[model samples]
Target: MSMADRIKTKLTERFHPLLLEVIDDSHRHHGHAGWQEGGETHFRVRIATRDFDGLSRVAQHRAVMSELDDELKERVHALNIEVIPADKA
Candidate 1:
């Protein structure tokens, strides 16, 4: 599966987010470090879920990063995350 698809699937399974948007920002970073010819190196993930309701920003980012550990280690170079609470979604 594509990196975006994998991110969506993992976040959906783990958080059951009310809203999730995985955007590939690689094209915007073209020619910069970590930018591959075919892209898929940079991403922005916006997710809203009750799971993140009580977590601090750092904790929320850690949780998301933990869920995507393999992808981060193997493929993804930069990951920007926005974790919103379900009520604020």
Candidate 2:
């Protein structure tokens, strides 16, 4: 499966987020370092879930990084994440 699909599936299974958007921004970074020919190196994830409501910003990012550890190490080169609370979404 694609990297985005993997991210969506993993996050959905783990958090049951109220909203999740996995955007592949690799195309925009073409020719930059770690930009592969077929893309899938950079991503932007917008996630809103009650699970993150009480966490600090760093904790929230860590939680997500933990979930996507394999992707980060294996394929994705850059990840920009926006973690929002369900109430705000």
Which candidate number maximizes lDDT? Answer: 2
Q: Roughly what TM-score does model 2 have, to 2 decimal places?
A: 0.97
lDDT of 1 by residue, 53-75 (tens): 88899999999999999999987
lDDT of 2 by residue, 27-64 (tens): 99999999998999999999999998889999999999
Mark the regions of model 2 whose C-alpha exceeds 4 Å error after superposition: none
Please list the C-alpha lDDT of all candidates, in the order they appear: 0.94, 0.95
Query: What is candidate 1's CA lDDT for residue 74?
Result: 82
Q: Point out the worst 10-residue segment of candidate 1 by lDDT.
A: 80-89
Candidate 1 has which clashing residue pairs, if any? none
Top candidate by TM-score: 2
Per-candidate TM-scores read 0.96, 0.97
- Residue-pair clashes per prediction, in order, are 0, 0
